[model samples]
Target: MRDLVRQGWTITAEETAALSPYIRAHITRFGAYATDVPGIEPEAFDPALDEIDFTVLDLAA
Candidate 1:
């Protein structure tokens, strides 16, 4: 998309309206949505994830 702009390729307002950031073609303007999430069983916890060190980090800017 950056290359297109560098090459002078331009998008009209209507064309831009048809496109979206990150996610595309999955948006619903108006609709009723429902899910039976309570009926689903949750995933079991993994004890192996506790072995990773979380305190070590290079947070300096």
Candidate 2:
């Protein structure tokens, strides 16, 4: 996630929700990593969904 952000992609809210559980768990147990991404605020994570709408910004466009 951080890698994508560093490369100029945007992780949408749905995508964040989809990944939130794993990301939160990882961050809690393994320490900071993906949460370091510019727009990935820890407060926004929600892991209660079965599906997500993933989108990315196309900087080339």
Candidate 3:
């Protein structure tokens, strides 16, 4: 999300892996990663990555 981006956290595993151990540990300690954080909107732009059928998925996949 934009909040995390603004705080310098990578949104993907690849980018996260490229980060230094210090930075990565900082993120793990203090990063804000939540699917629903009051007002931030989640993207479903990609079927492979971002597409989330929350209702169906949450119910029982």
Best-fitting candidate, scored by lDDT: 1
Cα lDDT tens digits, model 2, 9-58, are: 99998988776444443356755566457885557777865474444335
For all predicted structures, in order, the TM-scores are 0.28, 0.30, 0.21
Kindly give the stretch of ten consecutive residues in candidate 2 with the minimal lDDT sum.
52-61
| Candidate 3 lDDT score relative to the true structure | 0.68
Model 1, span 23-50: residue lDDT tens? 4467775665667566878789887777
Ranking according to TM-score, highest score first: 2, 1, 3
Model 2 spans with C-alpha error above 4 angstroms? 20-61
Scanning candidate 1 in windows of ten residues, the lowest lDDT window is 52-61
Cα lDDT over the full model 1: 0.73
Clash list (residue pairs), candidate 2: none
Evaluation by lDDT, superior candidate among 1 and 2: 1
